[model samples]
Target: MKKNGGIRFLRWLILFAKRFLKDDMPASSAQLTYYLTLALFPFLVFLINLLSYTKLSTWSLTEDLLTVLPAGTMQIITSVIRETIEAKSTTLLSFSALFALFSTSRAMNALNRALNKAYRVQGTRPIWKNAMLSFLFTMGLIVLIVATLSLMVFGQLIGEHLFTLLGASVYFLHIWNLMRYFLPVAIMVLIFSLFYRFMPNTEVRFSNVWRGAVFSTIGWIVASLLFSYYVNRFGSYTRVYGSLGGIIVFLVWLYLSSFILLVGGEINAVLLYGDSKIK
Candidate 1:
């Protein structure tokens, strides 16, 4: 039975690979990278402008972003924010906000198309409806980012205070420390699951999508960590690309992220629709 199970798993993996290549995910990921790169700076500007109206500090957001983004990429982003602040032009801010909204919506729309390809589904939604949904998704994504930053910034203080009142043990404090790491991971899974469930044109059950969501969350974290390690320890993009090195590295990282995200959708597609020939 164990041997049969192993064989079945191997066959499934092979089928997945074949379909992944057939879908030309690498090209699709490149397309996503383009839209994402275009949107990224404007989104940052929009975020900075929006934060000016709130009490939240940009430093918190930067720290959170650094957890996933390379230090070089963070430097670029931080420098942009700094320059934006120095300029302090109300018109630039206003334009950035509008442009950010439109570009981010386009990025989300591109992502929707890619995922549809993964699931082998046609674009059923009308252009206007798709545009509105993408716009809403972009807004929700911004809220999610802010909420995550807020949780990371304030969660510990709240936890400590509550634990003090309860007279929690030292061991409980250690567990809470562990939860600090888990919280971001949990949020990642939730985000992936939500996107997988709703982003595609077809109806996807929660049960069918959970596996892909978990796979994507884990794959993304692992890929980011490995990429970060290699870039920091051995890789020298600056030596090869000079001043544009940071941008190159950032694009590569985004491509990797895009590939993994779509692969997760492919996983779900295979599981839901692939034949049981192996079994």
Candidate 2:
């Protein structure tokens, strides 16, 4: 029974993949990539600036980013972050915040459209309503990122203290180290699940969303690791694009990331609607 169930699931997944492609994921992804690129630097600057006033340093923020981003991409991001911190001018803060809000909302809007398409639902929200929802989502994402960074920075300290109080052994420390990596990925999955649940026009059950979230998170991690490995080993965008290679690479990465996100939403749609045509 289990084996047959697995086969049936695979068949459904294959059909979902076909439907996703038919829905024009690539075009939507490209649009998302553009908005993401517009938002990326401003959002990072705003975030780093906000963190600078706190206990966290730019290096800590960069390290958190390094966990998921490729080496070259990380370098580019870190350089910009460092520059933003060193400039120390409040003049850009207002501008950065506004730009980040607008661009991020635009990106979220694109995702909202993609999700609606996947769910076979027509968009019924007014412009103001949609913009407000996007704004809220954008803020939620920023908060999620800040919380994740805080955990990465302080989780170890808290763990060590708890472990020492309990008289735990070295094995626990090893496990904690692994959790440091796994926790961020788990948080990402939860965030993706939230996006799946709330972003679409149609309602989704939490149970069904989790299936897609897990699938999407695993797919994202595998794709990111493989892309990073390929880039580190054989990729040479710098030789081809000179100083602009990093930007090019970043854009391509955003596109792939957007594609993965849509695929996840498609999975949820398939499960929810069961091969129904778009409404």
Candidate 3:
């Protein structure tokens, strides 16, 4: 019993460290999706701006309706963009034109693997189909952002109303303290629904998706906060590197985001695997 216990402890520790560093597993198909996500984020943002009622700047509908990240975050992002554009916007734009075709292939394969969670192994898709599905995924991404922003607005309104009724000061104390927790929970719920509804491969139980969603979400929030802290502290990489530093920041954020997502997938698979065996 003690021997088994030791092994379990070691395993848990290893997993925690991986959560901290978000190291990539080379063979993972999802890793390609990570790149695809990075390569595609800007394009998707462009599409969302054209189609949706939002711009990437202030009063962004996407943040209010879909992505609901905190205020002032966009300003940091804009600073990054401006710096990048000043340096090599044209080169990056040309590179994006070339990468759009190949990098998305990695993403399509990764999404297929995820759909596999819903059912049994299936045949591969044609290139056109992957593009179509990827496009659909892109649409879903916009809706998701809009929903988040909307919820954030609604939540803030409610929190404000409650504070007024309950002697604003004390209520304000609690609301301010819990913003991080509530905002992330809202996002987790949104992601859980997105996966449950859209994934095309198999029929995953709503429960499994949410469990994975929550796991992924918590990991994402903590990791991001830590990254911000590290960036502020030892690295101060953003300030020293100036606009160039944003690339480093972006790479770290993207890689870590991918790792958190995969960890959630791993946890979901473990739970599903156990359930299958028991049945």
Candidate 4:
């Protein structure tokens, strides 16, 4: 029975790969990349504006961004943030915040369409309804991002304070340190699970979404690490593209991210609904 189950699992995995390729992942990824390129700076400006009203240190926010972004890309992003802050252009900030919200929703709309295609469902919702949903999802995503950054910036401090208050041993600090790494992973899983559960038009069980979310999150982390390593070691984009290399690299990263997200949606579709529609 175990052997049969293993064989079935392998078959499913193979089918998923085939489906992912056939699903026009490249086109969808390109669309997402375009939208993201338009949205990136605006989104960052919106975030910075929101953070300005809070007690959170902008330095911590930059640090959090640097953790996930490639070094070259992060440098470009940081420079933009610094310039924007130094310029103190409220008009630009306000315009960027509104534009980012709408543009991000537009990107989410594209994602919604991709998810529907993955599930073999035609979009039946009204355009306005879909737009509203996308808008909500965009807002949710921004909140999730800010919350995640806050955790990364302050989680250790909070943990240490709690431990001291509880009179815990020094070993607790070691455990907290370990948890700092896992905390981001856990938050990512939660975000992915929510995306899987709600972004698609069809009903998906929480259990099924969790499975795909975990798989996708691990895949994304692996792919990102590998891509980062390759870029650092062998990439010569700067030599070829001159000053535009960083932008190119950022777009490629966004494309990879989009592909992985759609792949994850496909996995959930296959797992929940089988390969009947995906063939």
Candidate 5:
């Protein structure tokens, strides 16, 4: 039974690889990277505007991004945030909101098409319907991002307060500190799973999506860590590209992320269909 299981698994892996290549996922990822790049700054401006009305407005959101973003990318993001704050205005906010919606919807449409291709489904949804769904997904994604960031930023403080109120041991914080990192990962898995299950125009069981979600999450985390290390140690983008280095690095990172996300959907399609033909 063990030998048979291993053989079957190897066969599945081979099939998945073959189909992944046939799907031309790299090209799709490139398209996604373009739309994502266009949406990114607009989305950030919209989020900042929304957060300005909340306590989190004072929080340095870029600080958290520094963990994974390259120095050049971080510099660009910091500069953008500073400029946005310095030039805050209702007119700018409204314009950003509209631009964000339009750009994010385009990004979501790209994602939708990619996932549809991954699942080997025809995108039969009308343009308006797709636009509406993309808008909804964008809003949901923005909320999820804010929530995740809030949890990461305030989770420890909240935990400490609760511990103090409950008269818990100080050692509990060490455990909380460890668990905090894992918690965001869990949320990320949930987010990805939800997207995998729904973003595609097909019915997918939660069970079918969970494996892909976990794979994508771990793959993304590992890739980001490795890339960050590479950037910090050997990359001299600033010397090479001058002020534009940051944008270049950021686009490369987005491309990697987009590829991983689409590949996750491909993984789900493979597992769900098993050894069946993928066209």
Candidate 6:
């Protein structure tokens, strides 16, 4: 029997996606992503509103940082920040004081459960224990996140300064290319480290965390770019759906974030599930 080339290609693609996506791959990822996003939706809304009230979004700080970059690059970064802030909605702010810690913890439980369900592993952490762990871990995570932002900020500053001093130096150009690769690794380490330190039913392996973080972080960046492209090209939802656009976009991003969280669980499962290693 002659195999159809197109169908054969499709089958391989499906297998490839499943291997990387893990278990139910896209479907499982999507389920956890959507569920967790819906749960965390209000927190995001509150934070955005908080940022608005503080007028932090209109740029008092990045302007100082941008002075070192060429006008063109500076303009692009500033423009994206400006447009994103301006597009934010005030109605979302009304829900801020309404957030309950107890409820939020439950939402976190949902995330934990989603990951467990996807991989068929039982998570044994008590709710209070996981919540405490998540909270303390969040402080470290936030610090690392802030440090990454600083690294990124200082990185551009150094680059701009180097270009000013070195002008056409070919060596400087090569080093700049190297920064791109190393920076992503650093960012992924922070991301995966947080998940490793916090997400497991038991203590997690560092190697598992690293793989999950690196893979999922890369997936997230690619997904976000594609999502933006999609919204710009095919979605008129902001104008068409109004406030609901905020909900939809928020959901989309959260869904992806949750999926990334699950990837850490999947990695842990790959290593620790069944057999004798876990004991």
Clashes within 3 Å, all models in order: 0, 0, 18, 0, 0, 0
Clashing pairs in 5: none
Per-prediction TM-score: 0.89, 0.88, 0.57, 0.90, 0.90, 0.56
Better of 1 and 5 by TM-score: 5
Residue 110 shift from truth in candidate 6, angstroms: 2.9
Position 87, candidate 5: lDDT? 77
Residue 263 Cα positional deviation in candidate 3, in Å, after optimal superposition: 1.6
> What is the C-alpha lDDT profile of model 3 across 1-279, one tens digit per residue?
999999987775565444323323333434654655565555543433333333334334333332222223334555544444344445555555456544554565575565453233464556677667666664555455555555555556666667777766775857654783476467666664565434545456777667767876777777877776666556765467766675666556666766566556555544555434221
**CA lDDT of 112 in candidate 1?**
91
Cα lDDT of model 4 by residue, 20-136, tens digit: 777777788789778877887898887776667678778777786576666567778888778776665668778998889888887888888888888878889888888888887
Better of 2 and 4 by TM-score: 4
Measured with C-alpha atoms, the lDDT of residue 133 in candidate 3 is: 65
Prediction 6 TM-score vs. true? 0.56
Which residue segments of model 2 deviate by more than 4 Å?
A: 1-10, 162-176
Q: What residue pairs clash in candidate 1, if any at all?
A: none
Stretches of candidate 1 exceeding 4 Å from the true structure: 53-56, 161-175, 275-279
- The C-alpha stretches of model 5 lying farther than 4 A from their native spots are 1-6, 52-59, 126-129, 164-172
Measured by TM-score, how close is model 3 to the native structure?
Answer: 0.57
Error of 1 at 240 (Å): 0.8
- Better candidate number, 3 or 5, judged by TM-score: 5
Each candidate: RMSD: 2.9, 2.6, 7.7, 2.2, 2.3, 8.6
